[model samples]
Target chain A: MTGLADRRPEEDSVAMPRVSFTENLKRHVDCPPQDAAGGTVRAVLENVFADNPRLGTYVLDDQRRLRKHVTVFVNREMIADREGLSDAVGEGDEVFVFQALSGG
Target chain B: MTDAFHVATRKGLFRYERRNGGWQAGAPAFLGEPVSAVLTDPRDGAIYAALRLGHFGQKLHRSRDGGTSWEELEAPKFGAEPPPPSPANAENFEADMAARKAAQTVDTIWIMTAGGADQPGVLWAGTLPGALFKSKDHGESWSLVESLWNVPERAKWFGGGADLPGIHSVHVDPRDSAKLTVGVSCGGVWKSDDGGETWRQAGQGLRAAFLPPEMQYDPVSQDPHRLAHSGDTVWCQHHNGVFLSRDGGESFTEIEEAGPSVFGFAVATHPDDPESAWLVPGVKDETRVPVDGKFVVTRTRDGGKSFEALSNGLPDGPAWDLVYRHALDIDGTGERLVMGSTTGNCWLTEDGGDSWICVSTYLPPIAAVAWA
Candidate 1:
């Protein structure tokens, strides 16, 4: 069976998009800025969460949908699909996730 | 009998210790965070606290050395949705699809209870969205009790005070570890004879005045604000009135008269006597404040035949304190009881509600209180 340890070292050299989290979430769980490889918003977030699974819980609900008070913006435009998270992402794209100013 | 008690509040988890003939508050843990539930396992000295973060979702923490130190543990959560049914199986395809499509998440860990003495490392958690979870290894992990959640009658469950229905009371019968009774808001009472493998809707005589006249007596529609048990009898401070069930939870008889009003959210039953229980009486429905600006704790000793309003050491007039379901607790000896309210006032009774002393009046809105 193929495992993470068996992957080729060259695959790590590929360029990926940078994902950053809101400062408010740092108090609960850690989510430092990092680079992950993916083609869509869901894929990119999931890719980063693959290494830090606990961060995924802070951003998503049990149904794996983005939380009601969390918003994600790719570069400048906000992601259109909150549930499916199907917005496209390009190489070296800047993804910013922020907590909405709704709840106290 | 207990020297210490933990209070989960809107701001943090506070511990009160009986020191120098008075209860003293210690340094708060998780300061500036909302603690929804607190449980101190009687079998073991371990303490578990459930936090409901407004921004980061729900979290659970365990403290072994009282409340001095804590370790973060995975909170109870719902599992992934089940696979959709095939088109050939059209018996109840639409209903099945709709049920499956309505995804559920753990909005709040409303209550947590330690399993019976036989089950050492077991724990039970009831959460918002009306789901039960079991943890065999303390609070490290959890799994949904599908037997209770998948019941067909669960579709009728709806929200009461919160936006979604919540299971606020989980009572594990001391006589038998397998016998379990859980009280849900707007979902009536449910009993499981063989642990949580299966469940049945109980609480036969419960009535819901909020519903239409025709459905007032419906079993599944009754909203029990809190359920407390002592010995074989169960006491329920329902939304409409105070109901008592002598046979576990199979049936109930409403106590038509309880002090100034029969409506409240919290109930504390004596540990040794089934007929003795205490409830905080309040004006029901729209204005959930003290009846006529008089706050009192109503005690029934003659098995609901009569009740007395105990107000000594409490507020005299123009007081508004609404206690939540888990904010009232009785110690093992049943002599000492503590209660906190939404208005940040706490009272402690040393002589079983005959009188009470104000413990704290400046803490954040209290959610749950447990004797450690």
Candidate 2:
């Protein structure tokens, strides 16, 4: 099962993908990373939602653009632009995430 | 754990905790004259108290071993502090004085406690007339951010009567030290990306959906100035529901629409899950309560796309009342939920609003509840 046919990747992988990145979102009220699709920050996140429909609950609103508070990082670096997320991935890369939320 | 917290109320004092699913007051309550502020201090590692007297007259306190002991901090002797609300701003002085005497003040102090997460010993305060003040040296001294007071949105605040603002809740995200968001009651929400230097209303994706007449009711139309902004996306909780601001504060979209709990007071984003947050619905004007006559701590696990009432253990009696935004809070752990009510009691629900138990009482219908 090499994937692409399932809504959420459950039977696809023998090993979990690992990556590293830093979060630079404005508010720190958001955290916790979900699975990503590809190596690119956007692809990894899309893959995350693709594998876990529940992850879609946090990462996307009805409009499906990134929620205001949700940000994805690639290799410890934040991807400033949310619109273009079809980036490539590198093995052993670390992905960082952030939320754009605030409160007292 | 059960008897760890107590409160002093008018009808004596009461202490409570989660026994099973419902709440029950203690047979013998903690008796005192009642406290104005209930704050969890990060600096001293315990809860503290304070009493607000006009602008400069503040009586602060600390509980060394939690709420078990208390001591007052000497009020700073400001040699030339501006006179307390002078005759110039007091046409109805007597009435205003009376209101001040009856109304609770210091409890709106979460922002005033200072220092959390990355900020150590920073006292941030939001006040009526909607002003922002900061203290780098803890509560020993204070100085307004200075520029936030002069922001362009100031004029549009206060029914356009004055160019001042009411800084309701100053929340700094624990995850990101640079981000800060404060809400101004009728005006809207503002964000400080540069750590409170310059601020702009974050109104994108938010909707002031009070009908055209409501917008028309703005004593003054928001003068279309060149909104000095860098980004367009913003989120706001207006007199309306959760609003999303994809275009900063210029435009917005309403996210949650209860039948009539539109005028919500508290909106809390989830600590670990930004897509998930909690909001308490209140009456539009005290004439009625939220739907079902229950105080719901509704959660939207899917961001604002949907919301579900978490009132399984709340209430179904005459206990229903307005839950002010400042009155509600989630501890750093996000597992404990609390709110001080105008009904002279505060509540704690440990299991995500699955059930609620009064943690403290007789505290003159609490106006705010903050936990470190």
Docking class of 1: acceptable
Question: B177-262 in candidate 2: lDDT tens per residue?
Answer: 56666666556667777788877665444444443855733422321111111134333445645565444354655665643465
TM-score of chain B of each: 0.95, 0.70
Residues forming the 10-long window of minimal summed lDDT in candidate 1 chain A: A1-10
TM-score against truth, every candidate: 0.92, 0.57
Cα distance off (Å), candidate 1, residue B366: 1.2
lDDT of candidate 2?
Answer: 0.50
What's the true lDDT of residue B70 in model 2? 57
Residue-pair clashes, model 2: 51
Which portions of model 2 miss their true places by more than 4 Å? Answer: A1-104, B1-37, B43-46, B53-58, B74-110, B159-165, B209-236, B245-252, B286-288, B358-363
lDDT by residue (tens digit), candidate 1, A24-55: 88887878888788998989999998998889
DockQ of 1: 0.41
lDDT of each: 0.89, 0.50
DockQ, candidate 2, comes to 0.01
For every model in order, what is the number of clashing pairs? 0, 51
